[model samples]
Target: MVMCKDVVENIIGYIDAELDDKTLEELEKHLDECPECQVFVRTYRKMLELTGKLRERTFVTPEIRERLKQLLKSKLKPN
Candidate 1:
């Protein structure tokens, strides 16, 4: 069974549609029943949309993109 923690951990992949079939199915099942998780997903997507709008108005150079990628990679690494 997919748990709340699993939802959080796989959120990015889920939003990006990168999860495997089984995991994706499990996550969807959980989301269907979990109101809190449904809110979280909506909020997360809204945040992404707001940030994306801001990004659209700003100039993000290749250097900035690479730096952001490196920063995200570092932050996403398991301790």
Candidate 2:
């Protein structure tokens, strides 16, 4: 059984398909029994899909770029 904390720590790698076979199986088992994690995984997958769709387009609008910059700046600001 996987702890929720470990699942939280590794969820991104699991979504990226970087986990090994055994670890993947363990995570999958956890996901099956964990409704909260299941919701998180589904939302995360949707975010990835939307980002990928944006990437497939040849251009990003200036507004999008500015918003992304602001988001990055907010993240990078010192606490």
Candidate 3:
């Protein structure tokens, strides 16, 4: 059975349609049963979509910058 961490690790490939048939099958099975992973994958895809559409000269408010910084820090923190 695929774990949540496995889902997280492979999500980018899954979204890009780069995963192989066997791995993609496993991921689909996991996603079907895992609501948390489903949410995570959805959010990751949305982030990819937003970033791909981002303007080169976009403005970031100070508060938004700070929040993004915190989010990055938390994600990078060791569990």
Better of 1 and 2 by lDDT: 1
- What is the overall TM-score of model 2 with all chains considered together? 0.58
RMSD of each: 13.6, 11.6, 14.1
Q: What is the per-residue lDDT of model 2 for residues 33-58, given as tens digits with 9 covering 90 to 100?
A: 98998888888789888988986785
Find the candidate with the highest lDDT and give its number: 1
TM-score for each prediction?
0.69, 0.58, 0.65
True-structure lDDT of candidate 2 = 0.86
Tens digit per residue, CA lDDT, model 3, 1-79: 7999998888778878999999999989989999999899889888887898866656998999999999999999999
Question: lDDT tens string, model 1, 1-79?
Answer: 7888899999999999999999999999999999999999999999999988885575888999999999999999999
Clashing pairs in 2: none
- Residue 3, candidate 2: C-alpha displacement in angstroms: 2.1
lDDT of 3 at 77: 100
64 in model 1: Cα distance from truth in Å?
20
Where model 1 places Cα greater than 4 Å from the true spot, the runs are 57-79
Off by over 4 Å in 2: 56-79
Q: What is residue 50's positional error in candidate 2, in angstroms?
A: 1.3
Best by TM-score: 1
Better of 2 and 3 by TM-score: 3
